[model samples]
Structures are given as C-alpha cells and as structure tokens.
Target: MAETHFGEWIAAHYATLWPELFDPALIGATVGFLAGLAPGGGSALEFGVGTGRIAIPLQDQGLEVYGMELSPAMAAHLDGTGVEVLVGDYATAHMTRTFDIVYLLRNTITNLVTQDEQVRAFENAAAHLRPGGCFVVENYIPRLRDRVFAETPEHLGVEEYDLATQIAVSRHRWIIDGEQREFSSPHRYVWPAELDLMARIAGLRLRERWSDWHRAPFTAASTDHVSVWAKPFSHSRAVPNS
Candidate 1:
C-alpha cells in the first residue's frame, strides 16, 4: 500500500481528532516563529508537510514557505492556500529552490523505515538549502522503549477535550522490536546520534539540538527531539533557485 494511507487517515479525521489531541495552533505558530528566527526571514521549505498543519501557520508568520509531501490527498487540502505543495517523496524529491531554512516536523522523518532512506532524506534536505541555511527536525526521543518495558504505563493523559465528539484520545509511546528501539506509534525510531551522523554525511553541520520547541535541555525523560543543522555557504552552488 502507498504511504498515502497515513495521510488519508489523518485528513479524514483531522477536524475531529487533531484539535482534541494536540494544540495545532500552538505547534504551528511555534515552529513558524522558530524557523523565522533564522537569517533571511526564514525563507523555508518543509518535507512531509502533511495537510499543511505547520505550513499554514508558517506562512502566517510572514515567511515564504514551500512544501513537499508524499500524499495527494493532503496536497489537495492545501489548494487555494497559495502555499507551494508538491506531492512526492522527500528522499528522492528534488527542488531547484534553496531556502534559508528546511524542516521536517511531526516525527515524519521516521516514516522512512530504514537507515539508508533516512540518510537520503537528510541529503535531499541539504541539497535544497542555501549556503548557511538551516535544517530543523522535530521528533520524540527513544525513551519509549524503556517506558514500555517498565511495568508502569507512561501515562500520557489527555491534553485536551472535545465536548461534541466525546472521543478522548490519549498519547503514549512504547518499545517494540526487541527493545532495541521504541516508537510513538508503529514506525521505526531513530536516535539523535543517528540523525547527527546522517547530517554529517549530508555535508551539513549541527547547529543545535533541543528537547522541545522552547529549546528545553534534552533529558532521559524528555519525550521530544528538536535538532537544527546548517549548510555552509560553500555549498550554495549545489542548489539552484526554483
């Protein structure tokens, strides 16, 4: 089956499940501001911009935002928003425009399911960046493995509520595949070290790594990953303006 299933599932239930589960407004605005803080007004690109969840707010932040997504259903939802949404895979997708910032949010990077593909995704992101441009990625840390193996449930109590639907959704993470890895859901997990190595291979330099959008210090119990990388100006010739 195409990876489109995941996008379709989210699009079908976005209005119902999204707001109740997470604060989309807060997330989108926060990421946008963070990205905008980069040089050059944060002219940005996003890989896997599912349903414009973050892209829309990024635009509201006055940054020129472009996106590449793997799902047609999700792309269609972005119609008329004036946001550039291209339907394609991030690993092999190519764009002529290099931006000051490129981002992969919502743990979308882990969907690649393999190390080689994940590394390729980083390479692709690097290819689309201007010299001195930044690439940001946000994901949950791998602590889910320990939490799942422990007898106690790492309770992710409800963060919000929907009075109309009454479908209370709680979030949690767990370990699977022999405790070598953990996942927030069914996809594979990647460690921060692994991502750093991938960035190095892509000719990008690590700028910062944080536990949250607010730049919290990463810890054993931290449940999120936020990493930033920069491409040197010498690599500017590697990309073309689209």
Candidate 2:
C-alpha cells in the first residue's frame, strides 16, 4: 500500500492557513528573479507545489509553472489553478520536456528523509533543466545551540550528533487543537559547500546564493540560504558564465 503524505493532516486547511504566519507575496516576488518569472519568460518546475501558494503567483508573473506534488489531498487544491501538477515523487517522476528553472522552496527538500534521496532529487532537477537553466533551493540551517529541546507550539528536540555519520536526529511533537502528533524527521542538514558538491555531482554549478528571500547577503549570522545552481552550457567544460 502507498504511504500517506506527511502533510495529509494539514492538507485540507493549507490554502486558508498561514496568511499571518509569513508573507507569501514577498517570497513570490523574490523568487521570481530566480525563476525567470517575467513577460514571455521561460518555464519552471516546482518540486513540491503545495496548494499552488507559490506556483500560481509565479504563473501570474508570466512564467510557465508546472509542479510535482506527492499528496492527492494537497494536489486537489491545485485543481483549476492553471499550473500543471504531476503526482509522484520528484526524485523519479517523468516528464517529456525540460525547464528553464526548477525550484524546491520552503525547506521541502528535507521531506525526502534521506541523503541519497536528496541527492537523487538534485539529479532529477538536473535532468529536467535545460542548458543554462537554474535549480533553486531554499531551506533553513540547523540551529544547534545548547538547547536540548525547542518549546515552540510545535515541539522539536535535538539529540547530540553522531561523530562518525554526522547526522542529527530530531524528535518532533505537535498538538494541534488536542489532536496529538509525534514523529521523527531525520535530516542531513546541508552546508553551502555540501550543496555545491551535490550540484556538481548532478552536473550543475552554483550561480548565486542569498541569506534570505529579500536578496540579503548571507553571513554566519544567517539562519538559512536561498541558493541557485545552473546546468552547465557545456557539460564537457562544466563551467558557469561569469
């Protein structure tokens, strides 16, 4: 039997949710530049196009946006949104044509749950990108201060990292209006250098990286990064244009 999608619990409430949680408009506008979202612009593919929150807006900005969604319930929200959605794992989904830009936003890549799958996700993105196309990733940094556990509304606990494997396991818990939830999500928190290596392994090169959606410069103080990698114009050379 097929496994239920991770967001199934919140899928029904996704569209109307999170308005004040954060600003999607600003995020869309900022990502537009990387997606080539403009009048008669090139095409884009979003790996996890949940509820068309970002894809629809990007489509409105003139990019031909398509999506790969893993949840049927979440994909149902995309109906009549005009942005095409493919239902499957992005690591192995098939499409006839390539795109000008492919993006995985909002830390969705972590949902893959394993480093191998994460690397495969990059490979899939590389396969779907045209020469000179961009692959954009946005995810948070693992903030491992001395805190044993995070006590926000949503619960998250971090155990010590294993020295040999370099993997940090987090115990997560959530109680949404008394509907208790608990789970563990294993993450291979990737550094910028590691992401660059992944991109290189997938035949892409890092072009630009930013601290946030507002084009802020990335520094040690930054909590996350928005990075854009490009498919090389010449695979033999594997060099990016200046």
Candidate 3:
C-alpha cells in the first residue's frame, strides 16, 4: 500500500503550521482560477487535495468537488466540509465518474519520488478527465540554479540533487514554539519540457503555461509554473501527439 508523507501530527496542525497557505486571498485566487476553467456546474477532481483548502471553497463556487488524498489523517479534516474524498494514491486511483477538470497542485507530483509514479500520475489525471477536459498542475521550478541550501532564523533546509537520477533529497529543520522539528524527504524533480512529454504520453496536449494563477507570462526568471493540458475529444486512445 502507498503511504503518505503527511501524518497525524502534520494533519492536525496543518492550517496553524502553514498559515501563509491558508490566507483567504490566496485561497480565493486559486479557487477563482480553477473555477474559471470549469464550466458552470461542472465537476472537478483534485489530486492530493489535502485538507480541502481549495476544494471546499471551489465547491462553494458551485462546482462539484471531489478529492483524492493518501492520508486518512488529512482526509479527516474534510469531514462535513461538503467535499467528497477518496482515500488512495492519486497516481493510480480511479473514480467511477469522470470530471470536467482534474488538477494537481502545490508540487504534489514531486511527492511521488519516482519518475514512473509521476508519469502514472499524469496518466491518471488524463484517465479521469472527460473528453476535451483539462488537467492542471501547479509546481515550483527547481531552485538548483539559485542555491542548494536555504537557512533562516526559524527554519533551515538543504537540498541535494542527483542529476543522473533526477532525484532530490531535502532535509529541513524548524524551530517551532521554541522546540526543534525536523523532516527529510526524497523527490523527483521534473522540468517543464519533461512534464510536457509526460502529458503527451498521457494523450494530452499543452493548452497553456503561466507563471501564476493570475496568468502572468512564464519566464526564465519565474520560480513557479501552472500548466494546463487538454485531452483530445475525438478518441480516448488517440495517438500521442508528436
């Protein structure tokens, strides 16, 4: 069985620990962007929909929202939030009904920690979409070029990359409430070109790439990206775009 990096401690205190991500403006902006892509009354499926941060509000916007989460601890937070959840890995989980849009956000694809799993995640998203529907991914660009490590008064972290394996290991330490907390995880970092290739292998075509949810142009200097891919309406098994 697949396991989750986020566990009980992380789940119970997520909103309090990551207050920046829980900001109303940020959630509103993210939900607004996703809402625009989904037609009125359309359905959506969120891959790694931890705590329903975006799903609950998006559902409130009138779109039916479904979530796939690997952590039961995390899914517990969604109870009574009106967002239905499937407890399983997004990389291979299946839903009975397709959705108008499928999305993976916050660099969750990297959490797969292997190229094969990441590819399967893209395929899974395509499989869950209706014909001509869209799949969106929000991910941070690799910071290897800028620095290998980051440090602050409250937090410290370092990343080690293996170019040949396309894997990165990150170890982090934080001073929270005057105590020390630490975590380490391995991830596979993929470039934009590589992600596009994965989309093609999944029978999706690139629709747009932006620097942010606000639709700013993606540039070489940008630190993050939001990409959208569309499935062909003609056939479910159409030849992969060349």
Candidate 4:
C-alpha cells in the first residue's frame, strides 16, 4: 500500500473504465438503496471509493455519502465534488464517526492479501457503524475450477488459485491495443460461508444476499454476489484477535 500503484494506474485510465463501470443507468442509486440507504435519507460510507464514480451519483440521489479511498491518485478527482473523502489504507483507516450504511464494492475487500487482514477489516467496519447499520459487500464467486492460470487484456481472461487454503486469486494484466506496458494486479477471493463467519465474528448477521444489485436469486451457477450483513440493535458487539 506504499503508494497505491495499481490505483494510480486505474485512475489514469478511468476515462475508459468509467464508462464500463459507471454507466449502468444510475446503478449507484440502485446499489445505495440496497445497502440500506432509505428513500427518506441516510448516510453511506464507501470503501475503495475510486474516482467518485459511484459516489457522485449516489450523492445526487440525496444520500449523505462519504468516501474512504486508499489512493490519493484515485481520490484526486473527487476534489470540489462535495463528497467527503478520507484517503488512507483501508485496513487501518481512522473512522471517527459512524454511518447508517457501510459498503465495499467491486471486490474491494480482496485488496488485503491475507485472511487475517481481511477479517480485521470486517471487524473494523462493524465497529465503525451506528447500531442497526448494514455492511454490504459485492464480490465475485470463486470459480477457479478449470482456470488455474490465465491472462487478461492480452487474452480477455481471468485466473489464479492457491491450493491447501482455498484462497483464490484474480490475476489480470491489461496490455491493451496501444498501452505502453502491461499493468496487473492480483486480488484474493472469499467464499460465501467465509463471509458469514466474518459477519458472525463482528456481531452481525446475514440479512439479504443476491446474485446481483437487481436482487436476482443467488444460485449455484451465479458468478457474483451482493451480500448484506446487518448490525442488529440487540446484538451490537465485536470480537478481537486472541
């Protein structure tokens, strides 16, 4: 996390990535509501808030939104956008207040390379929320059955796997048609039940899970998921490392 090289790369290319990611016809509002931001009004805190792509639109819909971005390179675009951005490492961020909803989108949690770091982040997120707030995570399902290794931008594919630990990795390299050199990064992948355990340890519980932001049924064949974990008013607590 020294300088967030990958984030800089992404920020530099957002002109192209933004269209692919943010032009889903107000998908941000759709996801914000799913994260428990009421139609009336509520606050949202987004982790990995790259370039304010999702946040700016969510704010336009009337949600009081804030962002915690790990990369200044990516966050620079948020300037004068009216969104409160906190730039720092996501794992050990200094969140002074709580929000009604906390969300990590686009497999952002996987940026942490280890299980312990990922679990600690969940615990921190649980701690940084008001009672009854919800934690929403959108991530891909590990489908590394036949793809133990692959390349991207070069071949339009994704792949990675670590045996004996069940930790999958997303390996991608973007050597597009006219890019100078290749840009790549690998992110960890977590299973469905593993997320439940993380929620349980943080005194939260799974509330709603879907195959997509549209609330499609999560099935055996779904490639991704949007999972919600609620911090119940009656069960607010936290578990620390032993």
Candidate 5:
C-alpha cells in the first residue's frame, strides 16, 4: 500500500502550511484554464482534491466537479461544498461513471512514490475520462542539479534525491510554541518523457504541455509543467497508414 502523506495534522494546517497556493489570482488562473477545456456543461474529476481549494470555485463556475481523495480528514473540508467526494486512492479507485476531464494538481502525482503506482494513476485517469476527454496534470520539474531547502524562523526543510532509485525524501522540522514537530515524505520523481510514455501506455495522446497555467512555452529552463493528454474517440486498435 502507498503511504498517505496528508493526514489530520496536515489537513488542519493545510492553508497555513501552503499559504501561497491560496492566492486568489493563482486560483482564478488555474480555474480559468481548466474551465476553458470543459466548456458547455462539461464535468470534471479532481484527483487528490484536498480541502476543495480549486473544486469549490470551479464548481461555482457552473462545472460539475467530483473529487477522489485518500484522506478523510482532508475530504472533511469539502462538507456542504456540493462537490461529491469519493474517499479512496486515486491510482486504484474505480468509478461507475466517466467525466469530461480528470486532473491531478500541485505535483500530487509524486506522492505515489513508485513507478508502477504512477503508471496505474495514469491508467485510472484514462479509465475515468470520456471519449476525447482529457487528463491534466500540474507538477514540478525535478531539480536534481540543486537540492531543495526551506529555512525560516519556525521551520526547516530539506529535500534529498537518490538518482538510482529516483526517490526524493522531503524532511522537515518545525518549532511551534517552543515544541519540536517533524515530518517526512518520500516521492518518486519522474521525467516528462517518462510521463508521456505512461500516458501512451494508458491509451492517451499528449495534447499540450506548458510551463505554467498561463500557457507559457515549455523550455529547458522551465521548472514546472502543466500537461494535458486526450483519450481517443475509439479504443479499437489503430490501423497503420497505407
């Protein structure tokens, strides 16, 4: 089984821990981009929809939004938000119905921590997408050249990567009220080409890839990416060109 990094403590202080993600401008931009794809009464499914941060606003934009979450504590934040919540692992969960779009945001894909699980996540997303539908993902580019470090008066964070295993361990320690608190999570960092292969294996084709939500060009210097893959209209085996 995969480990769930987000739990009661993380849920309770989610906003506090990641305040930058709550910015209205960023949220608006993200919703605008997604809403553009699902025009004309289309429906959306958010994988790892934590705290209804984007789902709520997207729903308010007249889109039918559903969520698949692994943590009940995090899903609890969506109470009465009108966004249907399915408490289960997004990588392995099965839904009876399909949607116009399925998305994973904020580098949440890395949480799977294993290549097989990540591939399964893509397959599951494809399974939930309607014909010609899209599976979108927003994730950070792996920065193996330089290590990650976060330092503050109240907190310290360090991320170490193992090239052989492609495992990145994020370790953190926080001092709140003069008491010590610590947490760590493991992630399997994947390259863009690898993700593309996974999408192909899932019977989806790459539609677009950008450096950010603004549709900026993806270049070698880019540190993050938002990629979209579309399911073909028919699942029948493709015939070779004559």
Candidate 6:
C-alpha cells in the first residue's frame, strides 16, 4: 500500500474540508460518560488526538486525559486547554504513564497502511495500560464490496456547506478485495474481526463490542461503526511461600 498522497495538505485543510471536525468532542464526552460508569472511574489516553477533537472535551468532563498526535498543526490547536498533547507518531511513541483507559477512536486506525503496523499500535496501547486497564477503539467496519459507483446520493445542510472552499463532501463506496464497501469520507478500511485478531495478538482480550457510542448491538445491517473494549493481562499476584 502506498503512503497517503496528501498529509500536509490534509493537515492544512482539515478544518475547512470537514467543518464538523471539532464535533468529536461531543462523541468523546459521551465516551467519558460511559467509561465513568465503570468501576475505578479511570483516566484516559487518546491516540491520534487530532486537534483535540476528543481529548479536550474528555478532559473537560473531569477525566485526566492525555493525547498523542502525529501532526504538530493539530497539537498546536490544543494549546492552553491544559491537556497534555504530545506530538509524535502513535505507532512509535512511548509514554511514561499508563492510563486506566486508552482509546483510539474516529476510525483513526485505518491511517496505518498495513496490518502489521496496526497490530503494533495495539501492542503499544497494551504497553501503556496498567494491568486490567481497558483499551477502547471505535472504527468503521469495511464493506465486503465497493459501492463507489452505486450512486446513492446524499446532501449536507447549508451549515456544512462551503461555497468559497469549493469542497464537496460526499459518501461513496469502492471495491476492495471483491467486497462492496462504502467510505463516508476518504479513508482506508479494515475489518472489525481483523482488528480483534490484532488485539488478541497484542495480549489484550476483548471484553465488549458495540455498533455505536450508544452501545447498539452489532449486526449485519450495521456497517457504519463499531466500538471495542479490550483489557490488559489479568493481575493476579502470586503469594510468597508461607
């Protein structure tokens, strides 16, 4: 797989192309609210924290949140929010602190071109988690076929419109590996099962899976998004010889 052609250009135009890009904070708040329901009520680490879309709000919700992002431009956007934003690639970056919950949301995992890199990302997350901590991930399940030419048209409201920008955002499906698939925006796709396998290989166990932030049941009709929660290795201390 080739590297994405537009990195710097995308970083520059991210805010303009996706006017609702900042809306992930709402999604993050929802996540924090749900995670708070769990025992221990832990802190969070957001991988690929673009422009504090999620991290800032998660922090505002009173969860101790830190961010690891690759783009300096995105990190700079989080300035003065008091959230710790580290500029580095999530695949290779290391953090001294571990969190009760680590998350990689917004279909950011697809940014990795190959399965190997994606698995490595899981390992990194596991390493950053304390024993019994959870790793939460939200991603779209790739369609088995491409529907890019299916011609199902949809429109956005005027608030989402940018006339001077000349940027028309539309949903389309494309065929990959003989599967009919839909991409809401331009992005690489991966199978949810494949992600689960990657998590297993990284010594993490899947505790729960959902179709959406609302915890909808996953089914065939669901192709939009999936949220997975994985736990680190169990911490059963060995007793010293009496």
Against the hidden reference, what TM-scores do the models get?
A: 0.76, 0.82, 0.93, 0.86, 0.93, 0.72
Worst 10 residues of 1 by lDDT: 154-163
lDDT of 2 by residue, 44-126 (tens): 99998888777877777778889998888888888998899999988889799999888998777766756777788999999
Off by over 4 Å in 6: 1-16, 20-29, 32-34, 37-41, 144-188, 233-242
Candidate 4 residue 34 Cα shift, in angstroms, is 3.8
Task: Report the error of model 6 at residue 182, Å.
Answer: 19
Poorest stretch of ten by lDDT in candidate 2: 13-22
Please give the lDDT score at residue 226 for candidate 4.
Answer: 88
Candidates ranked by lDDT: 5, 3, 2, 4, 1, 6
Q: Give candidate 4's TM-score.
A: 0.86
lDDT of 6 by residue, 125-211 (tens): 988888777788787655434333233223222111223432223354434335554334334456677777777777777777777
Judge candidate 6 against the unseen true structure and give its global Cα lDDT, from 0 to 1. 0.64
Please, what is the whole-model Cα lDDT of each candidate in the order they appear?
0.69, 0.74, 0.87, 0.73, 0.89, 0.64
Per-residue lDDT of candidate 5, residues 115-175 (tens digit): 9999999999999999999999999889887665568887787789999999999888887
Q: Please report how far candidate 4 places residue 40 from its true position, in Å.
A: 0.7
Output the worst ten-in-a-row residue range by lDDT, candidate 3.
233-242
Candidate 1, after superposition: displacement of residue 120 in Å? 0.5
Q: On lDDT, who's better, 1 or 4?
A: 4
By the TM-score metric, which is better: model 4 or model 5?
Answer: 5
Candidate 1 lDDT, tens digit per residue, 1-242? 11544556556655444353258756755665465556445678889887777777777777888899888877888898978987899888898788888899877886776677888999999889888888899876654324332232322322222334322222343333223222233345677887888888888888787787777788876787788888877743233222
Residue 51 in candidate 2 has what lDDT?
Answer: 81
* Regions more than 4 Å wrong, model 1: 20-25, 144-186, 235-242
Q: How many clashes (backbone N, Cα, C below 3 Å) per candidate?
A: 0, 0, 0, 0, 0, 11
